[model samples]
Target: MTGAAIGGGLVVAWWFLPREYPNPLTPARGEHVLGAWLKIAEDGVVSVAVPQLEMGQGITTLIPQIVAEELGADWRQIAVEPAAAAPAYPNTPLAKRWISLWDPATAGLSGGVDDMLAERFATSNAFTATADGTSLAAYEQPAREAAAAARAMLAMEAADRWNASWEECEVYAGLVRLGDRRASFGELAAGAAGQSPPDPPPLRPELADETPQAGSSEADAGPAASFPRIDLPSKVDGSYRFAGDVRLPGMVFAAIRHGPNNGSELTGFNVERAQGIGGIVGAVKTKRWLAVAATTWWSAERALRAMEPQFKTQYPVSSEDIGARLDTLLTAGDSFKTHETGFGEEAMARVDMARRYEVDPFHAAPVETASAAARLSDGRLELWIATQAPEQTRAAAAKAVGLGIEDVALYPMAAGGSFDARLENDHAIEVAHIAKELGRPVHLTWSRREEMIRSRPYAPVYTLVGAQLAGEGEAEGGGAIDALKIRAATPPSTHEFGRRLFGNLTPWAAIRETTGMKDELAMEGMVPPYALPSVTVRHVPVETGYPSGRVRGNAYVAGTFAIESFVDEVAAQSGREPLSYRMSMLGSDVRLAACLQRAASLAEWDGGLDQSGQGLACLRIGDKETGGRIACVATARQGEGGLRVSRLTAAVDIGRIINLDIARQQIEGGLLFGLGIALGSPLAVRGGLPASFEYADLNLPKLGDCPEIVVDFLPRTDGTAAAGFDPGELGVGVVSPAIANALFSATGLRLRRLPLLSGGL
Candidate 1:
């Protein structure tokens, strides 16, 4: 891996080059690679290999948009196929090879990049990009290049046939035209088949000597723009394929019975009763798990229930116990201060006023429970799964089946929903294990209760916000914010994930422990956007028994809720309006200040306050990890039920917006997600398990409870932030803080902890 400092941050580039992988899009004619990611069929149906998983965030739609934009193909004609589980689909070449620099000024603004040629890192065929809010930022450029590569070939072929210069031909809407001559991309593709393709453009156009990259910025010019999502029609018609919808010729249903506690080893099980059960094929047993296979799913479920498996708990930890321990750590002051600046603890010591805020642990409940289908045929393994990380699924399934990566093929299925769910690949492994053992195709689906119990929930947070004001009108640096310190006691999801993924390797663990670096996912929103002179931010890592992962904004939602709410408090103390006070401290951060101002104005912040205890709040979302800007203003009222968000207005600057409909929808979806967590979705830990293990107990927000949201895009004319957008998780950061701020304005009663009113519930 190599890291390059570009723009304001480092962009990590992986050493792994894009390799040719079998194309699943057109399997009948065998796979043909066109610049790693692009594969042109003889029929002229341009198939672009997409690395990112589509979990209904419109990634699959946006990816095709970029390709169609560059390829000049009709959006309808282009097929957006899921890239197989191979080296071709990792994260992004830019992120893999470059360590993005964290810009402080923009850290508060969520600014986009400007020069694409200067920043486009490793371009490979590997569809190696994680699916998150930043999917657009991570995959857009590569998608552009892949489409352009195939288009270039078509243009070259057209130019050759017309006896004209390649530059004289233009590709548009699936046709190549030169002077009076014209040919469809399908015609050109057919002619170019079996013929030597045109040479690929240089990876970096500015430096011809540089190795050819897949998504070169220079080759990204085209006229493709927004189009209706391609996947929606099938989804609406119920023809879209999910893992649960998969069927194989000789498929057998398998049901799993995991240990009471995650990671517990299986002790023993009585399978005699289960075997005698009608339709029961057999039972596969492992030290850590057990599964029953049968001719039908109902029978498998029944047989699995009958085989009372015993599991030896490795640890006597419960959810309540973890909560109690976290409380102790919060008070102990023996935690690692992950981030510190200015006077650090000294500033907090001098504070005259302080407030403590806490957000309890929460679970993100996706409607779909885990499901997978796997088959071992002719010494080759195949799997169908709904996953956000398909490459990881492929790798895990291969590892579980004891097969080489090439022997295992993963057919990506459209997920019903994903909130950065943990065990995104766990269900695949389970299905693979059962199928390999039984020597028959196996389909496995986790029960809704199982999904709830095994959910990778958001960690509980304890935050202390302290500020010392300099006598009235004597604010520090002419800003309302004086000496400030934010101490957060958060369950370390990254630490836990690292231990789980690499704990068995002592050498890797030693290196990780010595480095003491937390994963970016864990610290998503830890950084403060404000310009506090004597600021100090500390993170105390606490362990939670269950696994945790990114669900929307992750720490950003939790941390930002505290910080933004604190900012509101400081503004109130300084005798200033929340919006004005925040803008005053923003200083030179024009982008963020602009967004806040825009959202406030659009929200009519001053027109009419919610007399029913209405409050207002703002959120800034542009950081090293997510390369975009989105400012949100939300209003809430104390209703009989709880905090009811009446309206939400967001000013977004995710550079260039792709599909306006999808972008807005993603932001809206994010707001609903944050509201769900703020209003409900609290995970109660009791007896080493989440007490709210099902929908009935989780209290998920429904459509009827959703607030009317308005999303406005900031004026943008093709710039840095335009190159990529992180709309998928954009609503997560702003919703919690905005709602919290609104709640305060309406009720004057500061409900700091998550679920807004933990006590009321």
Candidate 2:
């Protein structure tokens, strides 16, 4: 396949197009392969290859829907396939996202720092097709270009046969038509083969330069306002295969017994009598590993439970230990200062109001347990696992078996759910190691308790806010925020993640020093959009033995919670209406102000706290990496159960909406997820291990706990200022603060910590 299509725009596998076919879906004679993303068969059926994982996010459906719309193909005839591992199919959205984290002016430098980071992220093969709300934005440009190229190729083929210029032919509904004479894509498939795909007639603008909401003007697939999803049919018909569905011949079920906490090693075990059970296969034991293989999973479970393996450490440190360390760190001085706008240390001397808030550690608890099935035979290793980072799994698995990545075929399956848990593929590597050592195919699934014990929870965060308000008649009326200083302390999650990304070769500290972003994990999404004369944000890095990783919104959620909550405290202390105080400070940030206004109008804010316990909060968040802007409002009340979110409304602007139905669904999902975290999901630690390992132990919100949520997309009909768009939802970052603000309005007490834990409301 050729690298460049017509007009010099990149098509499929544009970065590193392969000389030979690289995917599993091979085209037959008379069929054409459009680069690496699309293929048209002799029967007019179109296949779209997606590199992202299908974790119930509707990405697989949305991506192909985009292609079908641009290609003029019937949605019914389109099929989606998982793409193979290749350097060409990189996570472009993530690359852009990392670059977005940097603000040239805020970083105290200008030049090409953002460009250098973007280049570094794009070339580095660190991410896989996992669900991170990046799929829609990442694949939008590539999918549109590939489909447009395919359309052009079909038009050219029709023109050649009709003896007319390509301009005279129009492609519609998978048919090339000129006046009344028409040719089906299947009929012109043979002629289109070996010809370079041409770009669409209307040259598309570069994603970076395009105006925001440009997609609102573009036509989507189907005449009906709501587009149908592709996965529902297969899911309803029971044809969709998850990791549990794979039943290979001669495969033995294995159960693992590892340290309860992550990074713990196995010490000893006793399995003599347990292995004698019926349908028992052998046992695989290593210094740091312990597993029992049997004919059935039940048998393996019985053997494992009976064995009762021991680890080097059991509940090494308790919850009190982690809490003490965090409290000490929060009280300590700052180690790294991220951004300083005006007054710096001078603002602290004139502080009019100050508040301290904390977010306790919580879990990104997905329903699915970590699982992997591996077969080692003939010096080749094959793994079928529910992993978000399949490329990382392939590399880690190959290294475990002492084989090259080429020798390992990693098949990423339909995951039940994943926020960031699947990003850590230690289980897949463990399964491969066991399979290789036993010289047999093994299917290892961690029990529910094991998954919880090994879960990488979000680190606890503490923030201290000191602000000086403006006097009456000064700058946009009275009570305007003049200067703000925020100091946040949290265990560094990104540094550890960076270490995993670069391995032992390059230290994470080196990357942090070179980038000058010492603790992005603690400070992102903490910056307020209010027009303040002076703003200083200090990130105090803390060291902890507890395992922490990115979960959904990551630092953004924690940072927003602290920043917004502190703002509410300041407004209350200043005796100004909370909403009005925010609006007064939002000078010229129309998008954010508009969202707050819309939400307030929807909720009918009357400048008084709801006696029935109503709270209102407005937020404006923009992500440069995903190209998204979200303004959300949340209303809460103290119901019979206490702290019930009665309603939530959001005004979203994320470029163009690919599928309105899916977009709304994602927003709703994001709201529920944020609510769960805001309400509670504390993973108590004791003896250096998670004390709460069962689903019942986690105080996750139920359907009854969640109130009605209303979402409205901001109309982008003009398409003037094109900000990049990511299809992911935005409520996670703002929910906690919104809810906390609501609680304060309902009651006189202000909640400084998250999960509202118990009677705090």
Candidate 3:
């Protein structure tokens, strides 16, 4: 059958299959389920089922807060449970967004969250993969409706007892009241479960939101968070469990070593040396990796080191080779136009200014390395792991152990910090194999060296930007850019990642399948947020012989870095101030323009003249209507040790803020992450392996290295903006270019490459 026919057949089959899925959150005795998303207990405690993984993003709290606000439940009584992989909870938004990746041939069959094909596919496959900041967009409305229905049911139950109309009852703070009569949600739980809901759920008119006080001082130190994070208490008390904390009866620890890169195979290992190590249980060897199990992780790691496994690489990757490939592709390779606007490339025959920028592959470098625990018994496989794509992980593990998908059970756990790193499930698959080989429960953890060797980093990019400006005598400096063109040379990173993620192909096979394809997702954000009359973006695919996957900010990081740096250079070439030059082209995007103006005001605008050591940059994440906007001003100077950033001031507009505290925390964290990428996180490939495995060697910013950060959110008027746009990635993309521009302002030299000092003085 053709690809489209197969996809259509699968969707139809899924539709006909039974949709009933047992509730993952089973109610305790005396508790009642009013909706699929939540349950109410006799103690008046509300347990909300969160479908997304909690990777320190405060999602556990955000979702419950929405329920509490709509259901009129007390925040103090709220509890959270991780939802099991089931058909009832499908991330339709994410499914629709990634339709092109998962079902390219039938992509046209899916439109939005309401698309039947996307919904059926997501539901049947239990596709709850969490990436791309789609949690709120995917779950908010359904959660609200569920909560509203539950509230109505509770009121109906209480009203019947009081001989009053349900519509006349008041429900708030976990209580239903009718004049002199009052009853807690716990008192009506059993009765509420049997009560019929209103035909149309009575949703609240307003969404959960918080407003920051005006002025720099007030905004800087906003009111205390109304709803504190739910996970903080357990996390602080060391009671929360991560994948590394999973311990089972007779569970042996396993440490693994994988070949450096794709197209590599394990050749040999010294079994005698490994057996001599104390506490060593046994060793498992595969075609591409070797693992040693022991009583403890340290012992297992030590045994693996003693074994001294060897691997042979057909084509070893090196930084120099990757760079040469990018350079060559950028200069003479055939380019595919990913996006175009206005006159497109026709107006790029002559340009008033041009510049080139380069960015090397950067690792995600999450705090926690890949870890998983697996057990194989009675023709079944059980896995405990923190994965963004739980179903995919389970399927991969089942396939690895030569079992059907129905024979696998996956227990989800919280991740330390993924930044999209947990999307890869190689560790889960390896642990399954190790457990099957040993016939015992095995907890496998990839050593930092193995993670650095096996994990795919973000793609390397080489960009050439050209612009046409008005005549010099027209306005102050050379006036506004009349036309712009950008040509970026990079591997089809997103396509390759999708091949591995959706197709479950090996890294080498993925690369071969998508070597020359144009990846529009990889070229996302290349279209400048500014209002240029004519703009064209071209993607020049380069086969870098190294696998690349999604990092935190994805393409936005590289795109913003190149665009903002080039814009700063253009501002200097013209006599216009950097801030004003950007603001001039932002007439169509008032939200971003407002952010730029506010950020400048907060940072004490200085026009970026006379080596002032202040640089400015702004970006829009989604689009003009519903996207998030951010503007940053970075202050930096050359320090004795190296480059030092003293402070960063940013003004952001993420629409109606859900939790102010979490939003600010996300932006602040994203800024620091971007800073790490700007100054560290360079992957230097040598013989197909990362040159350094230690985190300390990456030169990531320490507590002392972190600059004084000031974040101010643009206050929204009633319904002026869309519901909360994700603030997680907005800060990441803008910080790099802001720091680069600041460095140029500090020194006379413009650094066109990431890791600012990489190009040397």
Candidate 4:
């Protein structure tokens, strides 16, 4: 990979190489791990091919933009593909997602998504990843920085060709143009490739610096505010190749009929019956399931349909059994108050006078989750995974297959309906292991029933909360809340909060800790946007048989409902108008004010004056500085047998509006997610398995559920660009709170539990 000394005549090569491996976790340097990649092709496309399969969430759109920013190539000409699991690629997501999962504090305070954070790490050659260099924290910046540096190198090359200073040569939309002399990136590829890769690449500017939809070409020497998302068109048109579309000469397909029970391993299989069918390649048994391989998916289906295998039941799960268990769990008293305060003798004196009520909202639905891929090769494994943790599977698969990480190439394609369940990579890792053992191109997609049966699902949550009236001027009502605490981490974060109001239910420190705990305390309580004299929140971390990981908003779902509903409880007791109560509590928070005004306008919230009903939920995502801040207002109407969300409006004070359209899209998506979960979202489970095998039982939000989504984003005038993720989704998350609040306004039900307690079926 040598480069010439000539300025404009420089040349570079992005070579595709497999990673060497001993242990798959952290490969030696110069080996691909997962997220990171280094490729030198014949063209100037110095590539950093990732092994992490993109399962939507703008993965395809975001990565290419970063590469173009780094490679200085025309964004249109850049091509990015999933790297194979190897020491070279490491099979991790930019090496940064891992780190972010490990420690979120290093992600910084602001909602900034910097691509440089990922680039600072070494090649995917290591197994033990760091948060700063290999975590999800740098997901936004590392690649962007790398792309910008490549552009700088290319600009220098072009400047040399024109016999001018590099400053005179500008990169415009993958082109080198100086006055009348201009050439596309493709034309200057050879010259740019001839130069050695530069160190310490520059990052793109903040959103305040660049216009939306403008490619890097618009930048003045430096990386632009936003790189052109080259994959946008392909993904939009459904033209991009996904893993499901992979084709090999001798590739075959397979299907499995597994017991609908977790931990139900293989018992036995009858190959004679399967062998009687035509095109029945073979039947492999594992615990309680039989995997049949055939020339086509049809043949595999027919063989399985032709014969039913017998199995010994190990805790055989039925729909009825699951429902009974869930009901029992739900009926049980919530262990204890996650955030209980004013409980001492003096405080108890006041509790005797305050009116008390219980609000137990549970968002329960059955979701069938499946992740499977077709196996085409054995020595070199290719996986199609349905997971957000793409890198984890790639590395884990390589290790599981007794192959170096590079021997496994994971190509992420389109995915089935996904949620937080996609973050765990066990589905991919399991399929990869089974496919290789067969020595055939095996397709292992789960059945609708299988998805529900063998679920690594989020446990059903139940919460109990109690509050009392304040005595005299002693922080009456929900005063300042003193401090907001949250304890949402792995076991390492248990007891992170002392016995304080804030530290009880919403333990804030645990979230920032290194422990992998997903706060059990916040199963339904989170940060409140409402201001009081003193506010505090905390959580009690608990690790159960099913470690509740990224289960639908982590703490957002439970916490929002708990916090917002509790606020309403206070409002009801005081007989104060809900809107007025919230406003008074918020005081003068700028961002909250913006969201309230917009939402109120959308719903015509006139202090309970008109025919319209108003509901609002405050979002306190990021701090003022880290950006990505937002506020949302949601208004809904209850009709016969259905709830109509007439209007939902959001005013996001995040990232200074890099692209209003994109920001709005993100918010809308989040709304659908949160609203649907609030309404009739997933299927139900009885014993530990999903009762609903398909969408029919687990209904999603229909087109009718779509309300007018009015988005208002804060421009750079407020501050520089901030984090984009929270701002995008916070609006969607809390729409339910707003709707519930509105319902309380209209019906005076004051329902507190989720799947909101209703009168009608």
Model 4 scores what on Cα lDDT?
A: 0.50
Candidate 4, poorest ten consecutive residues by summed lDDT: 498-507
Off by over 4 Å in 2: 1-25, 28-31, 96-132, 199-226, 342-348, 472-478, 504-517, 608-612, 623-627, 721-724, 727-729, 758-761
Query: Taking the tens digit of each residue's C-alpha lDDT, what string does model 1 give over 274-393?
Result: 666798888888876788888888898888778788877655467567667667777685555556656666665466668888777776688888898998988799988877655556
The residue ranges of model 1 lying beyond 4 angstroms of the native Cα positions read: 1-33, 88-90, 93-129, 193-225, 268-277, 341-349, 474-479, 499-521, 607-612, 624-627, 640-642, 717-722
Assess every candidate by TM-score: 0.85, 0.88, 0.96, 0.74
Q: Model 3's lDDT to the true fold?
A: 0.87
**Which candidate leads in lDDT?**
3
Query: What tens digits encode model 2's per-residue C-alpha lDDT throughout 382-453?
Result: 999877767767888888789998899988787877877787777887899989877888888888877777
The runs of at least 3 residues in candidate 4 whose Cα sits more than 4 Å from the true structure, single-residue gaps closed, are: 1-53, 66-80, 83-137, 197-237, 268-276, 309-378, 404-406, 414-417, 471-525, 531-549, 608-611, 681-683, 721-728, 757-761
Please report, in order, the local distance difference test score of every candidate based on alpha carbons. Answer: 0.66, 0.69, 0.87, 0.50
Q: Report the candidate with higher TM-score, 2 versus 3.
A: 3
| lDDT at 113, model 4 | 40
lDDT of 3 at 578: 87
Q: In what order do the candidates fall by TM-score, top score first?
A: 3, 2, 1, 4
List all candidate RMSDs to the true structure.
Answer: 7.4, 5.8, 2.9, 9.8
Tens digit per residue, CA lDDT, model 4, 97-196: 3334333446433333423333333244332221111222334455555456656666777788788876676775657788998866545555664555
